[model samples]
Target: MTSKPLISVIVAVYNGAKTLQHCIDSVSNQTYLNKELIIIDGGSTDGTIEIIKSNQDKITYWESEPDNGIYHAWNKALGHASGDWICFLGSDDYLWKSSVFEEIIPHMIKAESQGTRMVYGQVARVTEDEEICCLDGDSWEYTWRGIIIDGIGSFAHQGMFHHRSIFELYGMFDVSFKIVGDYELLIRVFKEGGNAIFVNGLIVTGMQIGGITSNCVKLVNEMARARRKNRLRVITIPWLISYAWAICFPFLNYIIGERYVRYLVNFGKSSVTYLSYKKNVILEHKNDQ
Candidate 1:
């Protein structure tokens, strides 16, 4: 494996005009230059095409057409990718730092040489008001613990990088799964005896409070289906509770709004996380001197 393998950064979006430019600019400004940016738009009409057009130089391949859902658009982007390695980023997400790829490539090369096919990193969650919170901590370790537990730890797609061959081996994501396609793919990879590397640092910051996946009922149903298809024993307790909440959360959210819900749920944690990260940044800067 080369030190700087070509990495394909695929973004799947719909009506994401407002946040699309940030996503494009982050990839374009990456310190690791050997990458292709592919955008799959699901027939967006809200000025998304213009945003894509304005950033033509940064985008290697892009197309806008009606698709089944996010996973279908992801499959389209995968078809267009020409790089040795691939990673999917949401249209609303971006690399956490300009040097993220530079920090990640060596680990990937090492993983590849050791027969590992996928690599994942930590992600930060960014709120609508721009407050940042690290997803790393006691709740999740940067290891295959998530794979072992099957569905316990964080397995967000935005922070994962994949070697192109995994796709050939596992086939494309189950587009039938509107929300848990990434999890389904991960389960298949592990089931097939493929290995993955975990990079213990933040690579991307994805929007935390919205998207179709936020619909708890759909997510729970799709996850149960994936587990069953893999012949794993399914648990119904959490699913039942989630279904009950999902029934009422939308109405409560409509009355209280997302920002309020987020505030109530995340109250003290986000502030503490923000302060800790700021302190680390200052310490790193001072040590550089």
Candidate 2:
């Protein structure tokens, strides 16, 4: 491993043979050379293991075997990361283009120099056939109205880079969450009063269809728990408005289906995620999942 890595990219897989190789390749092509990648598999019986082994040289660090879920794999990856910055890009997701981290790293370092706790950027959705859609881009703007109510949009665990110290101070991913563990982790970052900045530039491929994160019900439940964990300051209007948005998501997706919903619902989600993105890294397995 390089003694001075600018970023550590972590990809967690559980039987994701079809997409795992593409995800790994995306990391290998990163514009940033001073990077290390960690692949933690969840006891996959599929060819996913073979694909990883084929790319063993590119994988700076990796592990195979059963794990609890995405967060568990992520927790394992964290221990092996030796970079100044960290992020988890899911097995099914890949950055849409090359040099995915190029636009954002300098800005992240600048903000970190100013003593900011973290830096987060925008994300877009990539269809199975590879068409792209924006979640938070030139097309949208989101603001945080209230603490608990802000999880409405599509800021993925993939879109942001986190500071390692934030995890040291806060704690690690809570495993109790079945779908929205990442959301719960964000709230903990907020409660700790971590400093962060929203980058106008975008990063990573996110807001995809068919992923566990695409489920509105799962998102709602995770947001509900995240709010509880943070002990929201007040029952703000955003919280009340969120209930309306939550109710509409399922029916909207059913009618519009996954493809169009990315352009529709994710606009607010990506913007909201900017305000809502966290600085926390996992410290313990308080997984309430």
Best by lDDT: 1
lDDT, candidate 2, at 223:
72
**lDDT (C-alpha) at residue 152 in model 1:** 29
Clashes of each: 0, 16
- What are the per-residue Cα lDDT tens digits for candidate 1 across 39-77? 999999999999999999999999999999888998888
Q: Mind giving the per-residue lDDT tens digits that candidate 2 earns over 6-71?
A: 788889888889998888888788777788889999888988889999999989988898789988
Candidate 1's C-alpha runs over 4 A off are 133-153, 192-194, 236-289
Cα lDDT computed for each candidate against the true fold: 0.74, 0.69
Residue 123's lDDT in candidate 1:
69
